[model samples]
Target: MDIIRIDDPRDPRVAAYLDIRERDLVGRHGRFVAEGKVVLDVLFSAGRFAVESVLVLENRLAGLESTLRKAAPALPVYVASGEIIDRIAGFHMHRGILAIGNRGAGQPAESLLATLPAGALVVVLVGIANHDNMGSIFRNAAAFGADAVLMDATCCDPLYRKAIRVSVGAALKVPFASFGDAGHITALLDRLGFGQFALSPRGETDIRDAQRTDRLALYLGTEGEGLPEALLSRLRTVRIAMAQGFDSLNVAAASAIALHHFSRGG
Candidate 1:
């Protein structure tokens, strides 16, 4: 495979890769950085996003020769020693694989929701700002056959490097879009004829006992505060039965159990 050797970290060709942690904070405009071999595999194979460029530690290139082959022949793949790569990234990259992906104009939530087939299962997230929780939720959504993930504006970007890495590349595979406020999302789901289920300890029915409709939207909110009382009371609320007094599960774990139960389609 043809490779470009980057001995200098500051070279203009590799500038997009510089100070990744800082860039992630300020946002990448329309671009996202994908790291690790697994994420790179998804970035190349998924076709959901356009790959801008690839930067790899020199020794890691041989192992990725086949994967890199999937890229357009003219695509630039920069190889650099570990030291140079570390200097550019502003942190140690143990996985030593990085690539920039551009998603362009993201699909509208309404457009994505309108395309689901009968028996669609989509996860709706609200006020979930933690990257790990966001990633875990997507991972579960992918694992359990969720058709799409719709998030409110309060949720963190799923394309963030840490979230994508935590999701084991599911972030790139599962289609997602951030919509407006909780009220707007709820109204749209209602308009789409989706049976909305808000998960909360105060829910009237146990999740195991909840019936899945042809179109179901499971709503998950941030930990501690959980879903809003107004929403919980209005929607068909369901709860994961827990032991006495202790009614807590990480939002991600809770989503898995709930998603798994409904995915079975009893």
Candidate 2:
């Protein structure tokens, strides 16, 4: 692998490489910058996305060239002086090696649903604004073998950098789609014949009490605010049994427990 040296931060070729820090502003196309050795390894092994380029600080990323050569020999790897990289990225240096890849294409909601096996379990999020919670939800959903994930328009992007890192790259593996409105989601699931259950701390029945159905869709809401009142009014509400001393769990933790319960035939 030939190391292409980059001395100027102003180089147009490295613009995408530097744009990673401002991923939120860059919108969908900027979903590619992966940091840390472990994350980079996961990104490369995923094979769902194409490698765009790689940037590294020579002194810090000594043997990474051989690693990249073994994993993606054909991709361009750029080596920059630490100072130049820092200037361009607007931050101090750590995790010397950064790799950029194209965002993998996601299947539409209807397409994903059509491919599901009978008795599928799906998790849906409505108006969840926190990226970390979104990522953790994806991680839990994957761990529990959820058939698919659906997000309402008000929710944060699951592929956002913070969400992706928080999910530990689980977002890359999970099948997910976004719906523009709750009414559309309800109607679509009804059309697909899915039994919809909304998870809320305050509910008439425990999640365990609900009969295990052939097709179940779990609806979760935002952190502090909980599920939107209007949406909750439209779906069956279910709660998790907890000790009398405790009233609630963090949305992510609650999701893990709930998903585990459903996965185990609850």
Predictions in order: lDDT: 0.89, 0.78
Clashing residue pairs found in predicted model 1 = none
lDDT of 1: 0.89
For residues 65-122, write the lDDT of model 1, one tens digit per residue: 8888877787789999999999999999887899999977988899998889888999
> Which residue pairs clash within candidate 2?
none
Flag regions of model 1 displaced more than 4 Å.
Answer: 264-266
Alpha-carbon shift of residue 88 in model 1 (angstroms): 1.1
lDDT of 2 by residue, 54-165 (tens): 7889885676644574456767778898888887677776767776768766667778888888889999898888988998998898788888999888898877777877
Clashes of 1: 0
